[model samples]
Target: MYKVKVFVTLRESVIDPQGTVAKDSLHKLNYGEVSDVRIGKYIELTLEKTDRNIDEIVKEMCEKLLVNLNVEDYRFEIEEVVAQ
Candidate 1:
Protein backbone atom coordinates (compact mmCIF):
# COMPACT_ATOMS: atom_id res chain seq x y z
CA MET A 1 0.00 0.00 0.00
CA TYR A 2 0.99 3.57 -0.48
CA LYS A 3 -0.03 6.97 0.80
CA VAL A 4 -0.42 10.00 -1.44
CA LYS A 5 -0.60 13.56 -0.25
CA VAL A 6 -1.75 16.24 -2.64
CA PHE A 7 -1.46 19.97 -2.24
CA VAL A 8 -2.99 22.60 -4.48
CA THR A 9 -2.21 26.28 -4.28
CA LEU A 10 -2.81 29.29 -6.44
CA ARG A 11 0.18 30.70 -8.21
CA GLU A 12 1.75 33.95 -7.18
CA SER A 13 0.33 37.10 -8.83
CA VAL A 14 -3.13 35.56 -8.70
CA ILE A 15 -5.47 37.41 -6.41
CA ASP A 16 -7.12 35.31 -3.75
CA PRO A 17 -10.29 37.00 -2.64
CA GLN A 18 -10.98 34.45 0.04
CA GLY A 19 -7.52 34.97 1.45
CA THR A 20 -8.09 38.67 1.40
CA VAL A 21 -11.22 38.17 3.43
CA ALA A 22 -9.28 36.18 5.97
CA LYS A 23 -6.69 38.91 6.20
CA ASP A 24 -9.38 41.45 6.79
CA SER A 25 -10.79 39.35 9.56
CA LEU A 26 -7.34 39.03 11.09
CA HIS A 27 -6.88 42.77 11.03
CA LYS A 28 -10.23 43.20 12.68
CA LEU A 29 -9.05 40.86 15.41
CA ASN A 30 -5.88 42.93 15.92
CA TYR A 31 -3.53 41.23 13.43
CA GLY A 32 -2.52 44.54 12.00
CA GLU A 33 0.66 43.36 10.28
CA VAL A 34 -1.17 40.82 8.16
CA SER A 35 0.16 41.27 4.68
CA ASP A 36 -1.62 38.52 2.79
CA VAL A 37 -3.30 35.18 3.15
CA ARG A 38 -3.74 32.29 0.76
CA ILE A 39 -5.84 29.19 0.87
CA GLY A 40 -5.45 25.75 -0.62
CA LYS A 41 -6.67 22.20 -0.29
CA TYR A 42 -4.88 19.20 1.10
CA ILE A 43 -5.95 15.71 0.15
CA GLU A 44 -4.73 12.43 1.45
CA LEU A 45 -5.30 9.25 -0.51
CA THR A 46 -4.61 5.66 0.38
CA LEU A 47 -3.78 3.67 -2.69
CA GLU A 48 -4.59 0.01 -2.52
CA LYS A 49 -1.54 -1.10 -4.40
CA THR A 50 1.72 0.65 -4.94
CA ASP A 51 5.44 0.35 -4.41
CA ARG A 52 8.54 2.32 -5.14
CA ASN A 53 7.13 3.24 -8.53
CA ILE A 54 4.20 5.06 -6.98
CA ASP A 55 5.88 8.40 -7.44
CA GLU A 56 5.27 8.50 -11.19
CA ILE A 57 1.64 7.55 -10.91
CA VAL A 58 0.94 10.16 -8.26
CA LYS A 59 2.73 12.78 -10.34
CA GLU A 60 0.59 11.92 -13.36
CA MET A 61 -2.61 12.19 -11.36
CA CYS A 62 -1.64 15.62 -10.11
CA GLU A 63 -0.90 16.79 -13.62
CA LYS A 64 -4.07 15.42 -15.14
CA LEU A 65 -6.70 16.11 -12.52
CA LEU A 66 -5.65 17.46 -9.16
CA VAL A 67 -4.47 20.85 -10.39
CA ASN A 68 -4.93 23.28 -13.24
CA LEU A 69 -1.68 23.77 -15.09
CA ASN A 70 -2.42 27.33 -16.18
CA VAL A 71 -3.52 29.00 -12.96
CA GLU A 72 -2.88 26.57 -10.15
CA ASP A 73 0.15 24.58 -9.16
CA TYR A 74 0.21 21.24 -7.42
CA ARG A 75 2.63 18.84 -5.84
CA PHE A 76 2.23 15.32 -4.48
CA GLU A 77 4.21 12.58 -2.88
CA ILE A 78 3.95 8.80 -2.62
CA GLU A 79 5.33 6.82 0.24
CA GLU A 80 5.25 3.11 0.80
CA VAL A 81 3.51 1.90 3.92
CA VAL A 82 5.78 0.30 6.42
CA ALA A 83 4.69 -2.47 8.71
CA GLN A 84 3.50 -1.24 12.05
Candidate 2:
Protein backbone atom coordinates (compact mmCIF):
# COMPACT_ATOMS: atom_id res chain seq x y z
CA MET A 1 0.00 0.00 0.00
CA TYR A 2 1.02 3.57 -0.69
CA LYS A 3 0.03 6.76 1.08
CA VAL A 4 -1.24 9.79 -0.81
CA LYS A 5 -1.53 13.23 0.74
CA VAL A 6 -3.58 15.76 -1.18
CA PHE A 7 -3.95 19.50 -0.56
CA VAL A 8 -6.74 21.49 -2.20
CA THR A 9 -6.62 25.28 -2.11
CA LEU A 10 -7.99 28.24 -3.98
CA ARG A 11 -6.06 29.75 -6.86
CA GLU A 12 -4.02 32.89 -6.24
CA SER A 13 -6.39 35.28 -7.99
CA VAL A 14 -9.49 33.63 -6.55
CA ILE A 15 -11.33 35.45 -3.78
CA ASP A 16 -12.08 33.43 -0.69
CA PRO A 17 -15.03 34.69 1.34
CA GLN A 18 -14.31 32.20 4.10
CA GLY A 19 -10.81 33.59 4.39
CA THR A 20 -12.15 37.13 4.64
CA VAL A 21 -14.51 36.09 7.42
CA ALA A 22 -11.67 34.50 9.35
CA LYS A 23 -9.50 37.56 8.90
CA ASP A 24 -12.24 39.80 10.20
CA SER A 25 -12.66 37.66 13.27
CA LEU A 26 -8.94 37.64 13.87
CA HIS A 27 -8.75 41.40 13.64
CA LYS A 28 -11.60 41.70 16.14
CA LEU A 29 -9.55 39.51 18.50
CA ASN A 30 -6.55 41.83 18.20
CA TYR A 31 -4.78 39.75 15.55
CA GLY A 32 -4.67 42.35 12.80
CA GLU A 33 -1.31 41.18 11.60
CA VAL A 34 -3.05 38.14 10.18
CA SER A 35 -4.21 39.84 7.04
CA ASP A 36 -5.02 36.67 5.15
CA VAL A 37 -6.65 33.42 6.08
CA ARG A 38 -7.23 30.66 3.54
CA ILE A 39 -9.39 27.66 4.19
CA GLY A 40 -8.75 24.43 2.32
CA LYS A 41 -9.16 20.69 2.52
CA TYR A 42 -6.58 17.98 3.16
CA ILE A 43 -7.23 14.39 2.20
CA GLU A 44 -5.16 11.28 2.71
CA LEU A 45 -5.77 8.10 0.75
CA THR A 46 -4.14 4.73 0.95
CA LEU A 47 -3.82 2.82 -2.31
CA GLU A 48 -3.82 -0.89 -1.96
CA LYS A 49 -2.58 -1.51 -5.44
CA THR A 50 0.75 -0.48 -6.82
CA ASP A 51 2.11 -0.41 -10.32
CA ARG A 52 5.00 1.12 -12.27
CA ASN A 53 3.53 4.61 -12.52
CA ILE A 54 1.51 4.80 -9.34
CA ASP A 55 2.30 8.41 -8.63
CA GLU A 56 1.14 9.60 -12.00
CA ILE A 57 -2.01 7.55 -11.90
CA VAL A 58 -2.86 8.73 -8.38
CA LYS A 59 -2.16 12.35 -9.26
CA GLU A 60 -4.56 12.09 -12.16
CA MET A 61 -7.20 10.68 -9.86
CA CYS A 62 -6.76 13.57 -7.45
CA GLU A 63 -7.10 16.09 -10.22
CA LYS A 64 -10.19 14.41 -11.58
CA LEU A 65 -11.99 13.63 -8.34
CA LEU A 66 -10.45 15.49 -5.39
CA VAL A 67 -9.93 18.96 -6.88
CA ASN A 68 -12.03 21.42 -8.79
CA LEU A 69 -10.00 22.38 -11.85
CA ASN A 70 -11.76 25.67 -12.42
CA VAL A 71 -11.23 27.63 -9.19
CA GLU A 72 -9.03 25.44 -7.04
CA ASP A 73 -5.48 24.12 -7.28
CA TYR A 74 -4.16 20.93 -5.83
CA ARG A 75 -0.87 19.24 -5.05
CA PHE A 76 -0.20 15.72 -3.89
CA GLU A 77 2.66 13.61 -2.63
CA ILE A 78 2.97 9.87 -2.55
CA GLU A 79 5.03 7.74 -0.19
CA GLU A 80 6.06 4.23 -1.08
CA VAL A 81 5.12 1.70 1.50
CA VAL A 82 7.66 -0.82 2.67
CA ALA A 83 6.46 -3.90 4.38
CA GLN A 84 7.89 -4.37 7.86
For all candidates, the clash counts are: 0, 0
TM-scores for all candidates: the values are 0.84, 0.89
The digit string of per-residue lDDT tens for model 1 on 1-84 reads 788889899998788889999999999999999888998889898987835467777787788887888878888777779769
Looking at model 1, report the run of 10 residues with the lowest lDDT sum: 48-57
lDDT of 2 by residue, 1-84 (tens): 888888899998999999999999999999979969999999998888655688788778877788888999988888878779
Q: What TM-score does candidate 2 reach?
A: 0.89
Candidate 2 residue-wise lDDT at 19:
92
How good is model 1 by TM-score? 0.84
lDDT, residue 44, candidate 1: 94
Q: What is the C-alpha lDDT of each candidate?
A: 0.84, 0.87
